[model samples]
Target chain A: MATKKFMFLNRKAPYGTVYALESLEVVLIGAAFEQDVSLAFIGDGVYQIAKNQNTDGIGMKNFSPTYKALGDYEVTKLYVEKESLEARGLTLDDLMDLTWEDEDDDYAEKPSIRLVSAAELAAVFDEQDVVLSF
Target chain B: MKYSIMVNEGPYTHQASDTALHFCKAALEAGHEIFRVFFYHDGVNNGTRFTVPPQDDRNIQQEWSKLASAHDIDLVVCIAAAQRRGIMDADEAKRQGIDGNNIAPGFRISGLGQLIEGGIIADRQLVFGD
Candidate 1:
């Protein structure tokens, strides 16, 4: 089968509901399917990958670490909307430093998180075969 | 073109279901093939036959059932989401010791794999949600 471009759009915050977690679950599964998968963190969805997400008091499982595992799943394209991060008074440094190894370059590490403008991301959406939002 | 639709919200509570229904109608009218309509999250409520809207209002559940029957479209309600929201098929209801199943005609309870399969097979996969 031809590989399709699949984008998982996340617009909700973590711990509020099951959207973020379930969205991640789908991404992990989509990885096994070996499609050209990309994850977009828009709006409060950026909070999902924010650093130091301590859920001890909230009594919820902290699945933030799973985002770091995206590299292993070959889901390397993680787009963080520039406007969304700025609107929330956050910088790229606040989020996890996710990376993937480039086998073509002798296993050289490459940054997976791409800080993109809204317009640029809109263009990216146009190039996708499937946009699964959560 | 083959199109797949995913509804993430329930009827009457959100406009997602309504938008998806209208979109499906438009797609069908345009001579497009509807590969599947996968209801997830609260969208599973759209497959339940127990929804009784006021006579003066639109019956969303009935509308979907009629559309599915007329077009011979596959209306799949995600089994995991349906189970979480108390929407079950006859077999599931019996297995879980529930009183009865509320799955509507022309609708079936299935897994998330159906959603993934739809995305793979269809030319487009449109998601309607909050």
Candidate 2:
């Protein structure tokens, strides 16, 4: 099968409804089908990646931690909007797992997830075979 | 190329619907035919006929109606989503004894098969959601 590029846009706050979780599942399925997958996080969607999220208070399982495993699914083209991060006072350090961040401060090492402007990310939407947002 | 577009976000609740509307317009402008636009999840709200916003502002529901009417767009609302949200058609409203129907004109209740079919027929299926 030909490689199909899939772009995912996440725009909701994590854990409110099942939208964010369902979006993640679709991206994983795309990856499983050997598609090239990229993710764009914007607005309240940034909350989906906040580190050390505690869901116990709401009696919900902590799903935020599962995001760190995206790389294992071969879904590495992560792009977080700079505006969303700055609006929430979230640095890249707050998104990646503490262990991963600790191991990769050096530029010689593997760079962390990429951050792109909203316009830059939107420019690539036309190229994708599919675009999923949730 | 035929296209399938899924909208999972509610209009007036977020920017997702606005973005999706713009994209739909652009898709048409680019000369790509859209096979269908599927409203699922919270997106079912976009088909509500009873929304009355401030008189000073533009009404989103009316705007959606105009878009569909003017372009002859196939506006489909997922049956499951609409039923769950209490957005019922004239038939369902009668059975449930509702005084008013919530389904707006220019939109129809549809099954998930419409979405799947869109994917099969369209060159691309893009989703805009929560």
Candidate 3:
């Protein structure tokens, strides 16, 4: 069977609605199928991977940490749009730490976040077998 | 190439319809055949024929009517979802003791089998959800 690559573009705020959580679940299921998976954060979706997320105030379970575990599912390609991150004053340091593969060691040691342009990310979607946006 | 589309947002309310329209147009341009367009959840509202927008604006119902009619696309709205939202066809209106059917032509109310069939038959099943 040919390998199927899946791209997930998350576009909702983290706390207001269930779209972010539900989208994470779908990605996990897709990972279980062993499909090649990657994620793109756009709009308010940048919050999904934002650091220092405290859901305790809402009496909700903190799920941001679950994102760090995505690497175990072979879903390590988490691409954040450079403009969105900069607009929110969020550097890679403002996100959870996971083993991110980077070309340079200095940046890799700090927070190995890979940033791509929105146009570049749009082209990435076309390359995938299935592109899901939430 | 044949494609199936799953629409989850209601009409004129969200970007789901707009994205679905874009995807459909792109697929057609790429020489693809659309096998079906399945409406689920709030999406069932798109099948209603009773919609009337401001006269100056582009009518959502009319836009979809033209697309489906011109392409001969199979627009299937989930029956269960439709009933919950009070969107009825002639048969459903009779059974529910409602006044009359308000759903437009070029759209059909059907079971989830349509979804499964589309998923199984089409080369791809593009989903437009909230």
Candidate 4:
């Protein structure tokens, strides 16, 4: 099977609708297929991986932990737009420290999340064979 | 080139469906193969036959049905989204003890795997949404 580069473009905020959750579901499934999967966080999507997300007030399940588990699924290429984070008044410290262990290098743990500017992220889009936005 | 379209919104409510339809038509005219058109989120509503639009307006459901029949394209409605919105085929309707099924012709309810398969099979997987 030919492996294709699948990029999930998340621009929606969590809990407004089912888009964020459903988009994550697809990502998890796609991870199992062992494809070259990357997730881009843009606009309100930056809030999805933000730290200390408390959904108790809204009575919704907090799925922020799943973002951390992406490493286990071998989905480590997480690109966060710098403009999006700054626009939302957030920094790298505001989000979870997502990382994956590099098995090739004796299981050395490495950071998974990479912050990129809007232009850089747009270039990432150009490299994708499949771009599924939510 | 092989193409796969993902519609993230429903008809009338958003222009995503309309845009996807136009893209599909143009792609077909250009002699491209559409692996599938996967309907997700509110897009699953496009498969429901219960929508009665105004006579003067173009019926989106019929348009999709006709296009699918004309091109033999796979019009798949995500089963998870469909079940949540009560859009089911005959078998699903019977299994759920529903009185009737509203799944339009040329559309089948399937798992999210179909969408992944489309991404894998198609040269480009285009997403049309808000």
Comparing only chain B with the true structure, the TM-scores of all models are 0.98, 0.91, 0.93, 0.98
Give one digit per residue, the lDDT tens place, for model 1 in A1-134. Answer: 66889999999998878889878877887888888999999999999999999999988899999999999889999999999999999998999889999999998899999999999999999999889999
lDDT of 2 by residue, A69-125 (tens): 777666767778988999988888888642223324362334436788878777777
lDDT tens digits by residue: candidate 2, B60-79:
77777887887898999878
The CAPRI-style docking tier of model 1 reads: medium
Better by TM-score, candidate 4 or 1: 4
Instruction: Tally clashes: model 1.
Output: 0
Q: Write the per-residue lDDT of candidate 4 for residues A111-130, one digit (tens) a residue.
A: 99999999999899898888
lDDT of 3 by residue, A18-65 (tens): 668756866776777666778889888888888899987898778888
Error of 3 at A108 (Å): 12
TM-score of chain B of 1: 0.98
**Winner of 2 and 4 under lDDT:** 4
Query: With candidate 1 superimposed using the best TM-score fit, by how many Å does residue B32's alpha carbon deviate from the native?
Result: 1.9
Q: Which residues of candidate 2, in runs, are more than 4 Å off?
A: A98-112, B9-121, B124-130
- Scored on chain A only, each candidate's TM-score is 0.98, 0.84, 0.86, 0.97
Report the lDDT tens digits of candidate 3 across residue range B1-130: 9999988788778988778877887888888999999887677888888888789876766667777998899988878778878888889889999998878778889876566556556778789887
> Tens digits of per-residue lDDT for model 1 on B1-130?
8999999999999999999999999988999999999998889999999999999999999999999999999999988888889998999999999999999999999988788889999988999998
Report, for every candidate in turn, its global Cα lDDT versus the true structure. 0.92, 0.76, 0.78, 0.93
Compute DockQ for each candidate against the true complex. Answer: 0.51, 0.17, 0.12, 0.72
Q: Give each candidate's fraction of reference contacts reproduced.
A: 0.35, 0.26, 0.13, 0.65
